[model samples]
Target: MDHEKVNILLVDDQPAKLLAYEVILKDLGENLVIASSGREALEVLLKTEIAVILVDVCMPELDGFELAAMIREHPRFQKTAMIFISAIQVSDIDRLRGYEMGAVDYVPVPVVPEVLRAKIKVFSELYRKTRELERLNQELEDRVRARTAELENSTAKLRESEQRRSMAIAAGKMGSWDWDWITGDWMWDEGQYRIFGVSPESFEVNPANVQALLHPDDVDQLRKAIAEFNSGTRAYETEFRIVRPDGEVRWCVGTAAATIDANGRVVRVSGVTVDITERKRAEERQNLLAREVDHRAKNALALAQSIVRLTRADEVKAYVNAVEGRINALARVHTILSLSSWQGAELSKLIDEELAPYSLGGQIRLAGPEVQLLPATAQTLALALHELFTNSAKYGALSTRSGRLMIAWQAENDRLTLTWEESGGPLVRTPKSRGFGTRSLLASVESQLGGQAQFDWRAEGLLCRLEVPLTRKTAASPAPGKFDAAAAAELQRASG
Candidate 1:
């Protein structure tokens, strides 16, 4: 739940006062953001969420009261708490102005530290709870991307004989059967005898014998189909298995209908059966492929979940933006794998797609041998590249007109090493703290793919190198540019 911590903004012109406020609130363990002036405070508010604002009443450029007014005008901050800290004496009108501008409380300077801390705690708790509730509601209403359905329309064949039964006949000579209730007799066509592996001369045709030949588990299915046909349905089609005299189990699709007299009494029944063993086998194969696809899709979603949980941002809007961008990068990789039928993807293709958003402008270069990556390798590598490209655009080579970037890679033995070099950008300085971007980059290259990530912060620019292990030599995930056997089995194992 600490992930739900809120930010507290302290605005003041004097550095000493800001330090004092920080000392008082540091014990609260919430994020403390300080701005030296009202304009700077407003900038912080624009990019970061502030559960409670501690503002100095008197400041250069923009005062606390004016800043509160501007903040309240925006719907997003209409209810955010503002506590004005004033050193001088306060009058009734001054208090009213602060209250009207969304001030929740006021602090007198040479302030009582305890009172300020207590006020901030209450608003921060309220803000965190509100955001949590909204998150839960959004999750409950979450809609899945898309779902595909395989539909097989069933139609009844028209009855052509005098008994007036109906069926949608198949192309081949289908085994036919008929029974008369009044005469208590049964008849079968030559095709029916051939299907049952029997001859009329050797075996007698009767309802009892026919029922005995049905697979034990499918007896109910046949009974149910006939029951439905007798219950005023014109025709019914059902698939079931049967045991022949030779003891062979064969799947059969039987279409049947009942003949009804004028008084609506069922008198005769007739139907046709077709050998559908091959079709049933085909259906089983299709089902296995569907499960493989399901497993692969879940793996991609799991990576997206990691990005959401691990990403860090100053504000809700920024957090959401970061997550969306990372997911889009993951989605593009999936799209590429899908186009290659999930066997594998070209390494150059993945790089090209990641670079498509940024124009070369004679500032970027790429050098790499043609390489192919297994499905899993391509996904993780795509995310790492996206992070690098996004960071460069924000603060490195791509951010400046005079800057330049070059990416090169080579495959040697069982490892692939890729280097990214930037020049002509702002002078490089190592950050004192590691942010989510840096951590995620390392995680993708090192933890995910069993690779090494080396970063060098030179005075002139930044450099990054990644050494990733190639896919193992396994039939499921073959060497680069190779796919054998059914990819479904390989993909399913990879997903696991």
Candidate 2:
């Protein structure tokens, strides 16, 4: 049925009759094979596809009925149409026999050329349509096979991509979620249940249920974010706290986008979330440290300025030395305070640092129980001690090699009293004027340390006493000093 060419076999004993049959069907544009005997016709049938066979009923050796029977016996030609042609009158019995042999039509001899051509034309058209239908069916089968392969390949690739995505999400501890806003339906993946500290089988994922799990302080903010998302004013990227079932609060960051319907209404929301509690805590600690450093740096700079302003000397170099020494004394106390995280400094350690530069083995003696002073108080006290030591080295007990000095302190009635006594040195007299060093010492003791200091010019040497509350109020941050021309002139006169 799918042959490239259709053949019509014409078998007869007379060549003239075969020629006449060819002429009649030649216009139909089909291959016409002529056979003088049934044997030749059989050969043509075996060699090519024959659409219709026209045979002479009275052929020699083999007749039309015999040839038709033989053709029908072959399974290959089972559907081949046969038309019998004869000049002799055909009886009903012979016609019935031809019909049984699969003859499609009986044409009497002296057959009308038009009738013959019409019959062949019908079979030719039927053969062409059958072959076309077979070709189309084959093409359709090929297409179905190709399409099935493509679909299978696509399904395999989709499965692989899903596997990779699942692995990535699991490794990152990320959770996915989906919400049907209109229906209040929520779906959470396995990771989400773990992050929320809940069993997925029993947890209700609606808005009210989820909100109940949120930290009380964060509930309002989260609601506002959701409201904005629902109003189409913002995409859902937010961070908030959730109180897990275990009573532990954790930080979570999530992002979601709404799916819009054809009517431009939000139908669903879906996104991913991650736990960020550790990161949040780390950020808080970092901020606190930064603030502490800023406060300390500002305080140190202000204290240095105050020292520079109070220092006086005849030359700039002398002034620099005085300021630097006082600042170093402050630095030494800071070093000790840093060990205690700036909580406080030990009083005895502070005294040792200030006296380190001028400590004479037998001359400088100190006695006091270890007491801690607040940071601001310790820094002020260190500067005062430095000034006192510098004056003693220049004009008091330590001015002479044989002079001796004793420093002692004791706490009583919630207050501390410190005595500075010098002996075996030149007689002391009250000075007619106070120098910058003496004024600075007095100002720092009262204004910075909230204490009182007194000096008695004794005949043997100078004696000083300091009285301060055991727990004096922490001094406020000092205002930065302005080292302008007027201040410089005032300091110079004080130095003189």
Give the poorly placed runs of model 2, Cα more than 4 Å off.
Answer: 1-205, 213-235, 242-251, 257-295, 315-317, 411-415, 470-472, 476-496
Best TM-score among the predictions, by candidate number: 2
Q: Which tens-of-lDDT digit does each residue in 1-496 have in candidate 1?
A: 3656789999999999999999999999999998999889889989997888999999988999999999999998998888999999889999999999889888897888898888888888888888888887776555321111111111211223412332323345368989885686888887788777789898888868888889999899867876776677878888888899889988888887788899987788888888887788899988966876766655655556666766778899988988998899989989999998888888888988998877567888889999888777787788889988888888888898889999999999978899999999988898776666777667555655677899898878889999987865332343322322222222233323
Q: What is the lDDT of candidate 2?
A: 0.81
lDDT tens per residue, model 2, 406-425 = 99998787677888898888
Q: Which candidate is the best by lDDT?
A: 2
Question: How good is model 1 by TM-score?
Answer: 0.42
| CA lDDT of each prediction against the hidden true structure | 0.80, 0.81
Where model 1 places Cα greater than 4 Å from the true spot, the runs are: 1-281, 473-496
Q: After superposition, how far is residue 54 of candidate 2 from its true place, in Å?
A: 64
